[model samples]
Target chain A: MRVLVAEDDRSSRMVTRRLLERLGHEVAVAEDGEEAWLQITSGEVFDVIISDWLMPRLDGHRLCQRIRRRENDHAVSYTYLILLTAMTDREHMLAGFEAGTDDFLSKPVDEAELVARLRVGERIMKLEQSLEAQVGELRTANEKLHADLQAAAMVQDSILPRNLPRDKRVSFGWEYLPCEQLAGDILNVIPINPDLYGVYLLDVSGHGVAAALKSVMISRVLSNDPLGSLLLGETPEESVTSPSRVLALLNERYPIDENSSDVSFFTIVYGLLDARKGTFRYANAGHPPVMVLRNGATELGKVGGPAIGMIDNWKFDEEEIQLDDSTRVYIYSDGIIENPNEEGEQFGYDRLAELIAGLGMCSTSRGATVVAGEARAWNPTEEIDDDVSVLVFGGDE
Target chain B: MSKSYPAIDQERLSAVSGGDREFEKELMEAFLEDAQLRVSQITEALQRQDTEALRSAAHTLKGAARNVGAAAIANVVMKIEEAASENELPGSDLLGEMTGEIARLVDQVRSSGT
Candidate 1:
């Protein structure tokens, strides 16, 4: 190890340097605290320092204070300081400890005691070095994970409905807010034909990467090529598959494994909208009710069984609604109504419907965005813990 | 001819010097020069009645004297330091005692040619 000896007296400095060198350590001599401070601040890292108590410019205690301050400010490596003090009183020892001296050596240092103290310093420095290395590695790993999540978020965003289908008779709008880097909520619109469109909003059971992966997989299947054939019928001549059958097909595909410990499931609202005819046929599988906006908000209540994947081979009921020119339909995830304020009161279903009804005849997109914002604002912290998704269509006027 | 001061521990000096005659001689010479410089500084401070300077110089000399195993000189300087620390001026008699101990240690170091 490299050691520094700071003594105003030449004889003591020479003696310390000689003793340290004899112990197979490289030694540097400083006439006083000022010289030692210069070498320390100028980027010469030393393992141990033996400093005299009283010196001209800077004293040993004050020098130790400055070293400790720099160590905290810049997070420099640790340097074990041994104050060479003749003041062995309890008061003086406490003062030296307050100044951050690691140990104390008498004015006439003992060679055996010096060797043992240096060994302790070496052990402490080695532990610090290894801990620093581990922290560096963990930081690198965390950064890589963050970058990967950002990339995944971007991919999920790309799959959403960027450009809604253009129709003077039917308009579509949606808002998706993810509380974390990855969200379990996903929604999309599938154009089955010129007259018909398939729309869906799905929320997996939980909120993070596991739930998000399942949502993404479901989204890929829903938006896969030949979606019209997949959703409507096996052939073009066959009639369109009802919303209930489509949901049943989905439930069968994502059934929960009874043998495994994971009982994960999802809730969804899938609908087939006849844009030309103003007819919406939808099935809700343990999801929040669909809000139909006319004079006031009306809820298309639950019609299906439990949430999809919870039970195998369960049958679901379908509901159909006839919308007029002034009707706007909204299907949303449970995150909107379940979000609680600071008072521990959830933004309930009634509050959500009243808030949307107050918007009156606003455009579908503006209404969706406003409701999403209001739901977020309901929480005092404004930190949503669940993924929020809202899909609106059928703005005929 | 070899000479020794009763207050100076020869064994302690030999241990510090690692039984090297040249190194022991070098240590004694360095201690002598530092002690002389500090002794004069103490004398001036005493003449001026500067308790702070007297305490500080005495402290330095005390440390160097202890390093050279001159306990008699170290003990005398320590008393001077303690007196000044208490804001009490060292009288002529105490000053004379400190100087006398320093002089004896210096003489013994010079006479003993390593």
Candidate 2:
């Protein structure tokens, strides 16, 4: 090992240098702390430093602190510091530790104990190097995972309905919030013709890259033709346009593959709204009930059925409600209703429907805010823990 | 010559020198020069009644002597440093004994070729 010996007395410095050189270490002698600091800063890395506590220009404690600061900034390896002093009091020892001295030795140093202390320092430095390498590896892997998730989120966003089925017969308002970088919900507004419209919302079981990927796959297949898996028509231009037929076809094709335990199922609500004839046809696959706000009353209805991909050969039901020009239709996921506050009380169905009914005929964005804002108001400290999606389709005048 | 101060073990110095007579000679010569300068400073401080300078010179001499395996000289210097630190002067007889021992050690190392 390369060692540095700093002492004011010429004879003592000579003795220490000779002893260390005899112990198989190359020794550098410094007259005082200032000279030793100059050698340390000259880019020569010494493995061990044996310095007298009392010296001119700078003290051993101060030198140890400066070395520690350099180590923290440069970060290659640790330099062992051994403070040599004649003062041997408990208070002095404690002060040495606070100043960052690694070890201590008395004046007229013992050659045997000095070598033994150096060996201990070598072992500690080896362990530190190993730990630093492991931390570096983990940081790199975490950054890669974060980048991959961000890219997947972008791909998922591109597949959503670019513009809600636009027409003078009705207006649409909607909002979607994902708890993380990715979400599990998929909704679309497909136009079958000038008079017919198809609206549906589906939610996968979990949130993340895997669940978002599943939703994207379903979005690509949701087309208004015989070629598409969702809302398939018997002919190229003529769609079946019936809520039950669309869901039944979906159930028959995408039943849970029992051998694959990793497969995820979903709950959904599908509907066909005919603005020209003033009729709504819809089916529910174990999703939340669709709300119909007419006149002064709020009506809740559900065409009950098991969530799709859960059970094989399960039948879905369709329900149609007579909606006037003043009436509004709301389709949403369970995230809103199931949101819990600090008191553990859910923002249940009654409160949600009542709040929306009071919102009247505002834009979908405005109404969605009121409901989302109410959830936040219930608890400031506890944020919502799940994804929320709301689609309001109404205003046929 | 009568051996008055033998607290310094010759075997310890030989072991530290690793049986190298030339290195042992160099160490003794360096220690002798350092001791001569410190002894003068201590005697001057005593003549001027400067307790701080007396204590400091004695402390340096004591540490330097012990480093070169001169334990007997180191112990005497230690007593002088302690006395000066307490604002008391060491006995004239003790001071005479310490200077005489340092002179004898230097003369023997100078005359005896390693």
Largest DockQ belongs to which candidate?
1
Best by TM-score: 1
User: How many angstroms is residue A317 displaced in model 2 relative to the true structure, after the best TM-score fit?
Assistant: 3.3
Model 2 scores what on Cα lDDT? 0.79
- Fnat for model 1? 0.60
- For model 1, the stretches where C-alpha displacement exceeds 4 angstroms are A88-99, A227-242, A255-265, B1-5, B91-96
TM-score of chain B of 2: 0.87
Measured against the true two-chain complex, the DockQ scores of the candidates, in the order shown, are 0.67, 0.65
TM-score of 1: 0.88
After superposing the true interface residues, what Cα RMSD does each candidate give? 1.0, 1.4
Best by lDDT: 1
List, residue by residue over B1-114, the lDDT tens digit for candidate 2: 215557455776775777787888888888888888998999899999998999999988988888777877887888899899899988897698788778778777777654
Question: Which pairs of residues collide in candidate 1?
Answer: none
